[model samples]
Target: MSADSTHAVEKDDAVFHLPGHPLPALVTLDSTDGSGVDLFMLSLRRPVLLNLFSMPVRDGRVDLPSVAQHECAQQLRSVNAELDALKQQMPELAVLGLSLHAPECLRRVREDLQLRFELLSDQQRAWTDKLELPLQSQDDGSQALRRCTMLLVEGQVSRLDFPLRQPSEVGRRAIELLRRETGTM
Candidate 1:
């Protein structure tokens, strides 16, 4: 393989485990609008807040029962509300949601929740597989992407919250980071 290809493979093999790690530049995700978003580029332009969530998959399709769907929606709403508050304080922040659902599914969720930020599809699991992100067991006993939040500043992870038990904590973590960075805490 070419040197560049080897370097790319090496980068992809490096699992991100903590804050201050650089996000791989080649990471791209499909937004609910069906547009490709290069997260590294977005972070370069402004701070990027990324929330990773997952829905149970059955027979290779998103499978969320009524109660499960309701719970997911509630979690998303809580996260969105926190992000809205954060956005009010920092307009330059680019809030995004990532999930294994298809773009169409994400679009529906976004519309249903009236989310203020974009939700990106990771159906192919490129971001998760490439980054080697942590996985969690679903209600069906299948593995799914673990819910986590990450704050990227200039393409480098500035803060990360893994195994997020409370979705609303996503925004609170970002706010805390901002406060510490600005010495306003």
Candidate 2:
């Protein structure tokens, strides 16, 4: 958001432990199963891929007069389509959706998107600040989590994709990484 996102990211002077990472501890989300999942606490004995994202709106910058026509059902469908696409592509890899919205928004996202993967609440953005992850702020002070990916192997962060800056791109590259790691390449 500041000229180039690359410049916004903070670089650590030294490596942080897998568990010590702030985001890891705050990395809680829900899965399609309707159960809570703690990504950091998960036993990643094998390679693990996690993709993070900022939620998108359908009207999507429509700053014009109200559209000629719209329906609640249509809105819900639109969101579900996107969510389904993400869920399908992000499987096997720990897919995470981080939002910079009010907790109220999460409920709406869950109901409207029919979301499958659990979502992380960056409402206060306490976790983002702790990790120094680059994020842009909404007027309300919520942060648009600048997208990134982390790869963990044998319970330690090995290579952080760290640059997969979009949800779809992140998913595509993460699946590719998982395939390579499994020798399915």
How does residue 61 of candidate 1 score in lDDT? 64
Please tell me which predicted candidate would have the highest TM-score against the true structure.
1
TM-score against native, each model: 0.79, 0.52
Candidate No. with top lDDT = 1
Name the TM-score of candidate 1.
0.79
Q: Which residue window of length 10 is worst by lDDT in model 2?
A: 62-71
Query: In model 1, where do residues sit more than 4 Å from their true spots?
Result: 1-16, 58-60, 64-70, 139-142
- Please, what are the lDDT tens digits per residue for candidate 1 over residues 1-185? 22321221223223244456667788789998789998889899998878777765666666645424544565577677787667766679888888877898788778767888889987788777766777777666766766666777887766665555665455576566555444565
- Give candidate 1's whole-model lDDT: 0.69
Evaluate model 2: give its TM-score. Answer: 0.52
lDDT of 2 by residue, 1-185 (tens): 12121221245322223222433564555443445555556625333454444553343332112211222223323333444443344344554555555455555555555655445555565555555655655444445655555555544444444544343355455545454444454
Alpha-carbon shift of residue 48 in model 2 (angstroms): 5.0
